[model samples]
Target: SQTIHQWPATLVQPVGSPLSLECTVEGTSNPNLYWYRQAAGRGLQLLFYSVGIGQISSEVPQNLSASRPQDRQFILSSKKLLLSDSGFYLCAWSPLGGRQPQHFGDGTRLSIL
Candidate 1:
């Protein structure tokens, strides 16, 4: 059985601060990882994705960046967060070849003050 974990279920930070969010998966290997953000009333927007270790694909141009250093660990980082960076961040995983639907972890609600 595969499961995903994300930390700091809720976060509050001042504008122009640094941000780091981590996600890890268990019971799977080399699964595709994705980072998505959902704004207050907007649909989900893909931030980044990884097919394997050290391989990442960015879907949007923003203050966010993603890295996959290990087989099951994905990290999202921002050196200088912006007010627009506040949103619900989600980490998801899927099987290879885009054949499986992604399973998402309970997201982190981020608020910029």
Candidate 2:
């Protein structure tokens, strides 16, 4: 079975600090990976996605970026953190070239102080 792993489970970072979050998948290859951020009660916002290695697509213009350095690895990073960046970030994956359900990780709860 395929599983998604994301970490750190929670984080508290000061404003203007650099940020790095990683997500990895096991038992899958060439899966479509996605990064989403949810603020408060708002719905999940698509931040970035990759259909293959080194093929990242930004869903919106934001203060963050994502990279797929390997077939089953995804990383989200920011040069400087913002107060608005504090939220629940989730990493997910679905089968490539299909409308299948995505498997999500436990998520990372980030708080900017």
Candidate 3:
């Protein structure tokens, strides 16, 4: 079975500050990875997706970027934070191919001050 580890379960940052959140998967190879944000009691907003290392697709126009530096690692970064960016950020992975159920990690709650 695969496991994802996401760090900093809670974060508080001021607007215009830089941010970096990381996620790494274990016991899986070449899995599809994703990042999304969800406001409390709202639908998910996809941020980024990766099929493999160095392959990333942005799902929304925002101040954030994602990178897959290794097969099992994904990182989300922002050069500047926005007030609207406060939400629940999640890391998830699915087995290769399509239509598979994605497994999510404990998400990070970001608050922009």
Query: Could you say which candidate leads in lDDT?
Result: 2
Q: Is candidate 2 or candidate 3 better by TM-score?
A: 2
In model 1, the worst 10-residue window by lDDT is 91-100
Clashes of 2: 0
Which 10-residue window of candidate 2 scores lowest in summed lDDT?
Answer: 96-105
lDDT of 1 at 36: 96
The best-first sequence of candidates by lDDT reads: 2, 3, 1
TM-score of each: 0.97, 0.98, 0.97
> What is the alpha-carbon RMSD of candidate 2 to the true structure?
0.7
Give lDDT tens digits, candidate 1, residues 9-68. Answer: 999999989999999999998899999999989899999999999999999988889999
Clashing pairs for predicted structure model 2, backbone only: none
**Which candidate would rank higher by lDDT, 1 or 3?**
3
* Per-model CA lDDT versus the true structure: 0.94, 0.96, 0.95
Better of 1 and 2 by lDDT: 2
lDDT of 2 by residue, 1-113 (tens): 99899999999999999999999999989999999999889899999999999999999998899999999999999999999999999999999984999999999999999
* Highest TM-score model number: 2
